[model samples]
Target chain A: MVFSKEVKSVRTQTWIGIMSVASLVAIAGIFLKVAMSTQPREENYENITKPGYAIRRKYFWALLIVSVVCLVISVISFPYPAIMEAKITGEPVVVKATGFQFGWELDKDVLPVGKPVRFDVTAKDVNHGFGIYYHGKDGSLKKGIFVAQTQAMPDYINKLYVTFKDPGVYRIWCLEYCGAAHHIMTYEFRVE
Target chain B: MDVADRSMYERRVSGIALGYGAITLVLFGVTVFFGVIMRTSQGEFISVRPDVLYEFMTLHSIGAGGSLMAGVMAVMWYTLRKHLDMSMNIMQVVFGIIGAAVVTIVAVTLLGYYGTGWTFLYPLPFKSAGAWYDFAPGMWLLALMCVIFAFAMSWIDVIRAASKKYGFSNAMGWTLISGTAKPENVPPPVVLISTVTAACGLLSLVAGFIVVSLMLIHWANPSYYLDYLFIKNLIYYFGHIVMNMIMYMCAAIVYELMPIYANRPWKSNKIVAISWNSAFVAVTLAYWHHLLQDFPQPLIFQFLGVFGSYMAAFPATVVTITGTLILIYKSGMKWKVAPLYMYLGLMGWAIGGFWAVMDAGFNQAVHNTMYVPSHFHTYLLVGAAFIFVGGLYHITEELGGCRDTFEDKLGLWTWFVGGYGFVLWFMISGVLGTPRRYAVQMPGTEIYSTAAVYFAWTVVFGLLIAIARYLTRLQSVKPLRG
Candidate 1:
């Protein structure tokens, strides 16, 4: 299946970049403004004698609140795990995954497209990351990053809920460096 | 003889601080080689196994972070001691503990192949999936526990000293909270370090508990388990605090040294006091932002974490930055490398900090992306690293009677250029969706590593010149006893 790769929000990214660059330019501008300034040094501007500090303090606090509010809003909008709040319209394909020394084992392989899949992951021997990757339009076998993941604990199961709208060959890789052949830890699946 | 009235306590503390700084510098030098090697391997210029690369990752992160903290802490202990009566006994003991911890850390990474990254999150340390000896994680945990104990002890000493001079509330800049005392009376550094000490002290205790808990589980019931979320939070809380404290304490160095370099007094004011106090309040919840991707962690925490982080982080950087810019505005001080590094450090801190805030902000979804490693590396290397180095150089030149001249401007420029270049690699790579801590590199990822490898070598060369100068000059001169 072909789709534009991970329609990463250009607007969001651009906004973040603008904020980052704007802050830099502002700080740098102020730094340059101050560093290059040949203004005569004022005397007795130590704490009590400093003027406009009240105004500075007021502005500082106001900016602090504004930035924090902005940050919280950004966090809310950013992509978060829909697992907890997800209302399943239909039953999610439940795949039981067990991880061990060198590999991953899944109970089933085929997953339907436009469906939610719940990966119930656990470890038989140790800790592992149940990281699932989708086949990009470029069709690369994902080794490093993954689409959805959760901890595969030895005694407890970690449930990860993910919905794939596009059908593609996907792979699961252990993200946590487990052992010597950890690089070889991979499992492939299908979305039909 | 020096004209200053010398106290034995002062001399002893200074000696230990120098000792710590020396060890830190040496550790950083070794770790940089590992970093360079890892980058080269990632660039596909060399062939190495995934395990080896992972091992180096663990070694390099802990080694460099530990080294920088030690260097800056030495400066903190040295400078703070002069102003406030810090504990000599605590300093001495920690100095010894740090030595032991360093040896053990090196052994665990080199000899035992403890490849669980510095975070050592959850059960990864307990169960290495057949890569390392069972003892490797145990040894690493114990060493880390020891390091935590030493750090906690030192922090306790700071708390005690601050509390002794100023009451706990005032030491924490409670006047800012209550609007009782004037900001000028609340000394910024004391308030700053005390706040940091409290946060780190709590984190260390939590770390100690988890380490001991994990050890007990290891020995008694090998099959025993933990709430992965709980352990993950604890470990990151410890790691985050450790990383930030390296900056917080180093900021003390900047707070003390920057003024001296500029020949001005950076007095405590309403802004400084309020900012530092706010940090004390907000820092407690900030580490949770690190776990926004962990799914199992609640959304409420993610929100709280992001808010707490920005609140804690923004104020101090803003106040210090504005303060520094204003200090240098009209002060006609010569821009020596020491002071230049200070300016550069502050600039890096501000820029890097912006990246960090963005990474924390959920709207970006940059956490766990390439953005994480790049932003952190920016802060750690360009921001915290420069602050600690500049502060150390300042302390040494003034008090330790060391003069460094005819140094490699070539090396310095190369370092600055390469450092920024390497930082850009991380930022760009992160933006382009290159994952961090990947043992084996994907094809496109090699491009970032290739650029980083060349840039890293320049950084190493610059450091080599700087370190050579420091060691030669410092070796002949004992901190203050001479």
Candidate 2:
């Protein structure tokens, strides 16, 4: 019965405590190794190509060290309960939406037949999955991910880079489940 | 083993079933385990190679699903047999077993080509596994046949139990049944609701069979006109109902057992009827929520699906919470292992329900992510499995007359704590942006370190809990004499 006055045996309690302590030590050791391996600036190597990534990297490491020290003092079961942002850098590019259609003017849509035009895609309110529909030789919408993953941005700007290597009209559509009228949210551009 | 008694015979049969289920679950678990490792490694220091991660990711989703289908179907077979008044038809049961065996054999033999997730979306199955992955039609056909046999057996049992207890006309004639029922009392509501859910399951199975056949036909010949979208719609229709069937089985167990703990036998007949009717209405309409993700489902369908989702969660929530309250205050309680199992089982179901509803509500940002898996895993593994285990234990005790020893008590505690803890931990990892199918978390992400720790802990806890329970159950007793 649940109310029975049975208590944990002292030996078992001690054993449990011992195991917990050992696990705690292992956890701490790993945390330290991760911290020491990546110097602050080096962590932002992925965003190196983006604007101001180098400078942001420096500050990011400093914040991390400070956070880790705070973590040690607070010493809860988990390490860093809040998400520690790995410093990223990019400027938002706004595009106009007309009714159920979205459009971007990149100064002359015509290019060589085999040339690739990469479009920076983002959404305004909720998450948007951008799928580019380029027609193949057979004329069906050749499906591919302009941005396969739903890139989350609070202010509705996501930079999606896609290359169009074939000449034809390619339609851009948001794949993420936005709100009502998502299906009609489409745009088209032609490659020469 | 020693000279085999009936219990031993039962044990051997159950053991083989358990072993098959366990290996399947473990394989599924291991695939997920490796996935966790890979997903964490990416943005974190732990990043494993992408190629390695991809291999596991591809296997993990599809593989785990295959195992789940096998395990749940197998467990249902055992439970369905026990619940029936008369023994089930041997031929049907054998057919179910062999059908499952063939599915498993085909699945394992062609593991190399089994990616494309369990949905086996048309072109993906063909594109990925080519002819070998094309074995899905066979898998689905077996599933449909298995469902028919399972349902027929279940229907026979329920109809017989209901007719024997309450005359068929009276059982349907009563508008409602009120107050709680005793443990053994087969309430018209419980019988009716379970039957309806089983019916829905049969419909879903048939739908799935039809869709999978078309998909196979499409695969056999790459036709430009093949509507993959329609096939997907049908698959989701069936796919969505199967989980509800599992939930209904657990609910049936809850309805049956809660009174035993509360000592409040059936009183009002009307309330029972209403509850059954409400469940029948809610469960049938609830298949729409599964289509809410990524798919281009209509807004009308989405709204209806969400409504059904909330409706489905509401009734069980009331029953379970009300039952728990009655057990707590109304009855001068005995806190034995069996009751503990039931109480904890209720808690698991309730917790699962809480997360399920929370995750369903679109307002909650957390619901959209991998955290959803955390919710479902809590429901399926703890909510469903815990109740199933408790029901099994009840039979092992009351029917088999097996008493709990100190070690058995330890086994119970280990299961309760280890399971709940592991799930909580797994959820934390999920919340940390550990992608569900990936072998590792995206590297250099903030959640990587914490997710890894939690994952590793879950694996440890799961192994310990599972092994301890396995050993405890291994301790046997004299069989039930006729």
Candidate 3:
């Protein structure tokens, strides 16, 4: 299967940047306006205080409402096991992943495309991160283009769920700093 | 106290503040140099051994954190001394402890090659894979303990003095909450903020002590096992709170000095009181955001992480940022270096804070990536660091009669432009899914790292110019009498 590389998450990240830039530009404008208007004038504290308080009241409410809305949206889309289970149609494939000092070991190397897969990741020593990177038609893992990740720590298994839409190689890189040669801690698998 | 006694006291405090400021400046310079090296190495501009790169990473974390903490604490101590009867002896001892700890940290990282990064995590230190000497981790932990101890001592004195003067409730602006505040009874914004930060700092230090002690015990005996998740929680709690307190300390400085520039009084109101009081609780809870990637962690706590993170922005945005804009609007405030840096600092705080809250909401996309460092660098370097630099300039001008020259303004603008440029690339890299703490950049990510190197150098050049100007002014110092 040939899949478009522009995934939903990438679009979401682009929106994050756009929104942040828009907000930042507006804020900078306000500061600049205030900064340039340096006319020598004195105003009564009492007069400013009353209106300031009223504005603050409204501002606080606006912030509260926006925050609550964001919180609701984020929680609904959170990548927990229960939420992941609800999104899939059939029983999910289970893969066990164990991370050691500079490498990863996955019990299942080939996963079915268009099917949900659960990665039960654990670490033998120290803590590592189980991060998956998608390699499209090229079949080579590109640096800095991760799709999903979760922590891999000793004595604990962290479950990460994903459905590969493309039949190609996916690479696993350690996201957490796990001592020497952490950058070389990479593993690869395929979906068919 | 008689006039002579008061004059002597003021001078003594001034001297100590300057001493701390000078030490902090040195730390900032060295740590920033280390940072430039790390970034350049990642960009492949220079070759550094992997072990050496990690060592620099460890030192940069501790050093940058220490510099900011010291700078803001100096500002707070200086500002609070006028209102409260804090002991100078305790501050002197803190200065000594910090100096010694810096030496120990450098020795351990350089000679012992202790490259476990700053958090040391849990077992990473013990499982160094023959990368470092056996004694390095224990020594590094002890050194950090000393630094925490020094900070704890300072907080104790601040709390003790404030409590003695205004009572604990009044110090925290609780009296304002009940509408029973008398003119003389209400603490200034600085005092209120400092008290809250100190209380929280003390609690975090206690957590630090517990976690460090546990690590030490485990290090001493291989038979004694530890829970990885539990230790991780405690570490983030302690580390995150300490960093937040340092930012709050910068706010305390701004609360005191921004008013002076605007020629208006920022008195403690009921709203101000409510915002900070809530912040005390919210800051601690917000540490959960750091653990959002730990899947086995409880789901409720993850929600709390998002909630706490958003709530943490409320006080800053609704109160401090808004109040600052109102105060300066048409107030004919002078755009001197002090207020200029401060104003930009507040802007950085607001911008950086917006991204921070966004990151909290969308943790899965950006966590542990360059985006993490990008957001923090925005607030820490451009926000908190700018505020401290502004405060230092204000203090020196007032006491030592240091005047802002043309070079000062030039340096300030250079720093402002370069600082933003440096962080912008980090943010972009993060968006591209580049993981942080990598000694060598993954092939494609090296492009962003390479771009960041030039910007980082610009910041260093700006800083050097500013430091030169500041040192020249120090020669003509004459302490002002009360």
**Residue lDDT tens for model 2, A22-79:** 4334433533343343333332322422323343345346534643553233222111
Where model 1 places Cα greater than 4 Å from the true spot, the runs are: A1-6, A9-33, A38-69, A72-75, A78-101, A115-127, A130-132, A137-165, B1-13, B182-185, B188-192, B195-203, B216-221, B400-411, B475-481
Q: After superposition, how far is residue B33 of candidate 2 from its true place, in Å?
A: 7.2
TM-scores of the models, in the given order? 0.88, 0.60, 0.97
Model 3 agreement with the true structure over B139-232: per-residue lDDT tens digits? 8898889998999999999999998998999998899998988878889999999999999889999999999999988878867899999999
**Which of the two, 2 or 3, has more DockQ?**
3
Better of 1 and 3 by lDDT: 3
Winner of 2 and 3 under TM-score: 3
lDDT tens per residue, model 1, B273-330: 6677666556668888877655556778877888887786556655766667766766
lDDT for each residue of candidate 1 in A1-192, tens digit (9 for 90 to 100): 333344333344545656766776776686666666524555444632253355456757876787868775775464444633355677778889998887989998888877777887888865666666666533464433335556676666667777776566777767555655665677888877
Higher-ranked by lDDT: 2 or 3: 3
